[model samples]
Target: MTALDTSKVSIKTSLAACFGRNLYEQPGAHEFLQELSQSAQEVNIQQGGYIFKEGDPSDYVFIAISGAIMLERSSPKGARHVFAFLFTGNLLGLSEFTVYSFSAVALTGATVVKINKRLIQNIFERHPKIAKSFHDFTTHVLHYVLDQMYILGQKTAPQRLAHFLLDMDTRLGRSSGQFYLPMNRIDIADYLGMSLETTSRSFSNLKKRKLIEIESSHKIIINDRAAILEFIDE
Candidate 1:
């Protein structure tokens, strides 16, 4: 894939056209992004390749330009915990405060844009709206973390699985009846705090109940929205 020059007229025009007021017309958004594009380097990561490890210096924030990125943490007992499965337009490394708390690894062949901390800080200082946008993004992330904690702590396997799918549909905007599962079953299990077999069985059970339909392509179809909605209560 060709690298994007953030300053060029073509990229700017396309971004302006695609985003309209949300991007191009926003206060300092285009300028900050243009500044970012000047230094943003696109890097490719193969599936399973690490973008960064836990405890590493938080010098850079990465934007997922393409494919999915997995944020993972390992427990003392060596259990893998998936913090998130980030897709296109998702930002990583913003919540770490200083050092990376979780490792960012590629769930698939991915492309990322690396932005240094200095650049971000400078832009944020100049653009109050941009800073507020970042603040809002982090706040949403915190809420998501709390929601996951509740699911893992109190929800049963089926409930957790149901909640996970619903949340994925909302976050990924995959409400077109089909949602793709890029991460493997093991990763889903880890994310949901269940065993791999349990996670797999949950999917099978959902299919049997006519709540969802799973395809070999890793695509899932929500057959009955009401049934899926009431699953957590049951």
Candidate 2:
């Protein structure tokens, strides 16, 4: 709930980055970004802190500026289902309903820009192009959810793990195929809908097959992406 004096410049930079160069380079995009920056309030969240809980009023939208964010939901019986791990430049807290359908939590010490949904709506009304861009962004998010559904509904345990690794590689990996995992095995298990033991076994299996190298619990290097892809195909 504590707000930081996040500079307008920083907000503009993060917004532009999240919107992508293609959109930012569009006519009037600079002014539109500035308006968004001016309306945004930045907040720093400690590790494991809740940004917004499920059922809270969907009054604001958040854009990640740094670190990782976990979007999840809990069953009445207290089981948790992780939806996604959002990194820098990802958007969250967007809901069509009056209340949030899921909770957003900081996976690490994170910074995020919070903008009132009403204010954004007003801005979007004025900037049709920006609104179109945002629509496209939401479409991408929908596709991501669909992909996760496919992974959970159809893939085997090892195939699910493979898809998860490839996804993290796409999101957080370097050209050298090394990436640092922000979430632990338990988080991975929850996100992939597998037991922690099964998730761990899948990682071990990949390591045994020389498809990936485990530098540490958090650091991973894909030794052979082709083989990993082949395994997933099999």
The collision pairs in model 1 are none
lDDT for each residue of candidate 1 in 169-233, tens digit (9 for 90 to 100): 76565566667878889999888988999999998888887888887737787766678879887
Error of 2 at 140 (Å): 1.4
lDDT of 2 by residue, 143-200 (tens): 9889889879988998899888988898887446899999999999999999999999
The TM-scores, one per candidate, come to: 0.87, 0.91
Off by over 4 Å in 1: 1-3, 7-21, 95-97, 171-173
| Model number with the top TM-score | 2
- Enumerate clash totals for all models, in the order shown: 0, 0
lDDT of 2 at 86: 92
Clash-forming residue pairs, model 2? none
Q: Which stretches in model 2 have alpha-carbon errors above 4 Å?
A: 1-13
